[model samples]
Target: MRDKLLMAYRSIRERRTRSILTVLGIAVGIAAIVSLMSVGYGMEEAITGELTGYADFIGVFPAKITGTTYVELGSFTDRDLKDVQRIGGIKEFSAMTFDSAEVEYRNKRVPIFFISGDTKELESMYVEPVGLKEGRWLRENDYKGCVIGDRVANDYFDEVVHVNDKLIINGEKFIVVGVFEKASTLYASDIDPYIFLTLRATKEALQTDEINYIMVRVYDIEEAEEIAEEIKEAINDNHGLDDFANAMTMGSMIEMMGDVFNIIRGVLVGIAAIALVVASIGIMNTMLMSVMERTHEIGVMKAIGAKSSDVLSLFLLESSMVSLVGGVVGCVLGAVAAKVISLGAGTALGIEFGAVVKPEVLLGGMVVAMVVGVLAGFYPARKASRMSPVEAVRHE
Candidate 1:
């Protein structure tokens, strides 16, 4: 084996240009797979962590299907909320209204997400989990008070807002009671750029009682999914519409996200696999050319008592060595590429997540390259080994 490897090494070194190009072909394919898959894994991790944080919580939204498209049809009514609240296993629930409105502070106006709910219920159900950065949660009667997210307080306005700061929401004045800590995930409920108000205040400011959704917390998380289904049925029945509303638990959301990620990852990997297939073809062409060029050498070896098996092994080793080297280089390039992609995407999306390249991924890459090498070299090695030594020597 040692002698065979040294001979193969010398052969590759002799044709440095062709060997290097073939190796690069394999490397590029591996790098693409590694980088894309790593980013997918990282995103999956971030979203899964965020969803798990609300594992016992369920969100009920008023929605309907209109000609194959799901849309937010109408606001949840008080009757719908009453029916949902009567469902078994619900520990607590809160109705929230969402709106997009302009907030003015220090003579500057900014469009912001304006959310309103029962202050105390909202704090225990949503705010406390992410925690407050400063001040206190709004009281149920603090109709003129609000809590701001980290981004809204510091990043939105030219002036940094603080607790006790007065802001104008839809022309109505309200004081900042608290600021929430910055959220780490990149989901819709990030809370880092939101402003929360009491239900009464929002109704007064907007002149409407439009509850967008209801959030429910289950006493037993293990039964949350079942309770969510019951809540959905109850709400739909109360409204006399089959598709009036939908309820989903956090755990179910996570599972749906996982399924989506898996499909995306598979598609990306499949595209990358095309490159690997092309690389394998390149390997086969290179090995076949080597066999033709070294015909006389092969003949001489056979004349000197070398078995057909010996010739086969030598060619196989040469191909495997080239592929193994490519795999090593590919792994390095892949890791660097993954990091660059992660950083670039994080910057563009305004969210932080790292590339997740596991040891298993590197090992799998190497093994795949080896298998491709062996398969690509097989035919050429066989052709070279089965040659008639006398005919081969006499021809060239």
Candidate 2:
């Protein structure tokens, strides 16, 4: 048995190119599934963490759920904002509006997407209060005053866009009150414009009383998600609004992303199953070909008193060793591919998955590869064991 197994190993090693190609093919499929899922999960986590850093951020939309960036067609009557302020369990809240316009300075013009809204009770809850680069932060009852993005400052408004600098917007004039430190994380809210202003001013300039959205800071920050659920039920009961249940808490979103990743993991595992099956078939074919070509040698061993069980064990051992080597090679290749994708594409695309080869994914891939190798060897090993010595010797 030992001699036969060693012979099988030697024969496969002699054809290293074919064996390596088969393993590489299987590795390619496994790596793709593993890498894509890992990155997706990572991105979701990063965004969730960014969301949670806010003290008590919550968003409310009339037709859509909260935490969504979609803006539906509706005017947020001043009355609606007042009614929301009266809701129970609400520590504080703010109303915000949005618009896009071209900002023109003395000789240059640049487009800026800006959020215009009123100053209200909940500045801390809704915004993290950006660092003021120029004059000062927004003041109470400050109108015709706007904050510029730092990027806007350097490029459009010359070297210094000071507090008193005039900004032309859609031919309307606004005094630059302050500049924000560079913005971070696009996941903040629906308002992604280059300027921030009072809600009343936004209404007057944009010609709409409707705010783009509203944010509510819950009394207990930890219960934000739970309270958001409660808020949904209450709104449904009172407003007779159905499917307007899009309120989301940062914690709840993280939890929901977790569930989604689990489902995605299951799908990736399913794809791995198919790939393993294919690789297993290749191993089986290699083993059977080895059996056919070595039949005469097998017959010689049997005639020399090699038992059928001995013959079977030897063939099985040969295939197992071959599979084991394939598994190791596949694991290395898959990890490399995953890392390359995570670092190369991750950085280039700015998706920023921390690192590639997640421990769970690596362990799972190795286990699947070994199982595929063993299963592929089984039937061919059995066939080699049952051959008749006399017939095999006479055949060729």
- Segments of candidate 1 deviating more than 4 angstroms: 64-70, 105-110, 124-136, 150-165, 347-350, 386-391, 394-396
TM-score of model 1 (CA atoms): 0.87
lDDT of 1: 0.86
The 10-residue segment of model 1 with minimum total lDDT is 64-73
Best-fitting candidate, scored by TM-score: 1
Give all candidates' CA lDDT scores.
0.86, 0.67
Question: Which 10 successive residues of model 2 have the least lDDT summed?
Answer: 184-193
lDDT of 2 by residue, 54-134 (tens): 647566666564343564645455655666676667886777765577888886787888776555433343346345556
Deviation in Å, model 2, residue 116 alpha carbon: 3.4
